[model samples]
Target chain A: MQIIIVVLLSILTILIIGLLLWKWRVRRQFRKEEQKRRLRELELTAIRSQMNPHFLFNSLNSVQNLVQQNKGREAHLYLSDFAGLIRKVLNNSEKEEVSLAEELELIRQYLNLEKLRFDFEFEVLVDETIDAHNTQVPSLLLQPFVENAIVHGLQNKRGEKHLKIDVMKKDAFVLITITDNGIGRKAAKEIQQQKNGKGTKLMKERLNILQQKQGEKYKLTTTDLEEGTLVEIVLPEEK
Target chain B: MQIKSIIVDDEKHGRENLAGLLESHCPEVILVGLANSVKSAIQLIKNEKPQLVFLDIEMPGENGFQLLEHFADINFEVIFVTAYDNYAIKAIRFSAADYILKPINFNELKTAVEKVTKRIQKKEENRQIRELNRNILQPDNPRIGLPTNDRIEFVEVKKIVHCKGESNYTHIYLHEKKHLLVAKTLVEFEDLLKEYSFVRTHKSHLVNLKHVVAYSKTDGGTLELSNSDKIFISRRRKDEVLQMLKTSIA
Candidate 1:
């Protein structure tokens, strides 16, 4: 009986050591994987942060011009509003996803800045069925397309410029459409000197990365209208 | 004395906006004519012989800059009006010419007009306009104007080594161990030099990537410039600085 007991105690010790070794190996692998994921996140953030350089600087210039004009009250208001937008962008930098409501607020703020430069009418509509506060979408997914509509379509247009955004619920996906009444893509291309569409390309790459990482369905389509262009983005309800 | 001026912009709103501002704030600027295109602007300039021309740089057929090519000698003062044009703005700044960004700020318009009025009174020649044309034609070798205490100094961008920011002023270090103290802020310099391979390694330091010889990883990180000067890499900017260096070198 004593010999049997001693043999059982030895077997139990060996099993515990083996289990501990396995746990340590698994933990090390997990840590390495976590590190890799963080690096990739950092890279995505870099790509996402490529906001329009022209808009950024031009907005600052507008502020400076206002101050120099001695419109102290107007300058103060413009600067504060601009600062708030910047803060929102910075706050969302680390986040992979944000509520649809927050995203719309950001877009509204951005449009306000553009309004300072161009006279345009803008409107945003949300479907009654969709809850923007609860719906999760990829952060800054639609900015590039909206910017393209303004810069390429409306910038050189002759008459009144109009921009509209519509959000609706469609099956398992959320549909967002951006419509602009400005010069068509073909005309814009003819005028611009081969300035490649780097922003659009970067945005497409980001969308692909997000889709792959999150295992979600994402769709984008652009239609050139007779007067302007329309961009539609369909994203999964849950990111 | 009224300073006769012409407004030339393709956009209707732009023309009306500037016209209204001039009518309201600038009583000294008498509007003689308005042109929608460079072709019309040339005709107006010859017919009116205005003392000032508020020119829009980007138009459909011919840009505002091309209008200058039509004249052998620019007699009237030109103040470029544009919403945004990076290359054109740089050339304008380099030539020490006057420019105002749109959504026309009344104060900026008044200031630009005031300066032009002074120049008109002094009968100063428009040498800067000629310089601007030269810079536009030869964009490969761009120069930057640094304002000193008394006068402005124009230097080729490639010759500058680095810059140090102190309070509001900046000390510009150039090649051959020469440096100049300018009245401009480091932020302004950074904006101008950013596209020209200048990187801000720290809040107080902006360095030319071309002048960097080596980067050391010891004690966080440090950069050894071609001038044998050491610049520290801030903890926050270490990753970005390395990334910029990699792209610049490759």
Candidate 2:
């Protein structure tokens, strides 16, 4: 009986030791995978900074339109703002994360140039509850969604168009809601002569890649509102 | 083990009728206690900590919603019994709660009982598991692994606001205001999410009851969500919508 008891105790100790070793191996594998994912995200982030030539041509055409129409002063201001936004975008592509304030300012510059070209109304509302300085977001994350909101959601609408963006923190996630009171998805689809031509497919792919980086926590939901489209991006709160 | 439940109604007949129905019909519910007022009901609940409560909306001193306000972190399922007119019913439907009206039909009672049986037990277990601390970034709900097309996303059930049927595809809208167009049909999703707060608001639409903001009576009632999105409510489902609204509260 004494020999049997000692044998059983040794077996239990061996099982526990084996379990600990297995757990350590699994944890190391996970860490390695996480490192690999971060590297991939970094590479994608750099490649995404390449500006589309069509957008450049469109902006240039607008500038030419302004120059031909002899709106010299306005054209000059538009050119400078466009230049400033591109410079900022290029600079930001080198960083992993930027202050929320800096990111929003970049977005503002982009919107300003777009507004000068399109003459549309827009609003940016950072919630009072949020500490703008403390919150850090990955650069260029919000640009694609904002561009989609402007180009697809609001471009075709008649009368006064409004685009509103709200940034609020929910638990450990930063929820960014972009609302555009313009023609909705069904209407936009009806008018689309080209299939996913206007960077929407690219936007979707970028979002998917971003979602992969955050695993399941990252969520991007687009709901068709009563009069327009509401795109919500929930990203992990990284400071 | 059977789940402990309480019946709360001002009328003795009402309480007894519900208790009798449970005794005869619902084998899953172990009727532990009964109460007639919000005051006594609170005491009973505090002591018993029952998993389910069959509450009447029109109590003498305080209504059902007021009773709910007394407690934070309501850990039990509540199925309200109400004598409804038009406005109150609309409000109940707007909230996406579960309820059975006075002169409750046999079928409605049976279905409500079955629904409560399935959900309340799951709630208790889920609640206990949810209380455990998880990785900070992960939401505190069971992750649903959805494999659609090339990508397999493990999404939290709570984040899914609604799923709409578009021909052969299902468009799942999340809390983050993201729409995922999946190749699977709505029926497949409905089957997977049968245990959740999703309800068939329309044949083409299945909405999460928790995300429902209001029910607009205009154009024969429409469902408004928190995201300012609107969905149509079929005429046949007006009552079912009300019941769903009530069950959603827990």
Interface RMSD values for all candidates? 16.0, 25.1
For candidate 2, lDDT tens digit of each residue in A1-239? Answer: 99999999999999999999999999987975875576556545433543667666777788789999999656755665566566666656655455576678778877876776567899899877765544546566677777777777788888988899899879867898989988888888788755532344444555565445444346778899999999898766431
Q: What TM-score would each prediction reach against the true structure? A: 0.53, 0.40
Candidate 2: RMSD to truth:
25.2
Per-residue lDDT over B1-250 for candidate 2, one digit per residue giving the tens place of the 0 to 100 score: 5879999999999998778767766777898899999999999999999988888877779876677767756778777787654444433432334567665544567787776677665553322212211211243464554546644455677788888876557788887688788765565566456457787766567888888988778877788887668988765456667777877875
lDDT of each prediction vs. the true structure? Answer: 0.80, 0.70
- Give the DockQ (2 decimals) of all models: 0.03, 0.01
Q: Which stretches of candidate 1 lie over 4 Å from their true place?
A: A1-239, B90-96, B217-219
Highest DockQ model number:
1
Worst 10 residues of 2 chain A by lDDT: A196-205
Candidate 1 per-residue C-alpha lDDT over B7-38 given as tens digits, one digit per residue, 9 for 90 to 100: 99999999998999888889999999999999
What's the TM for model 1?
A: 0.53
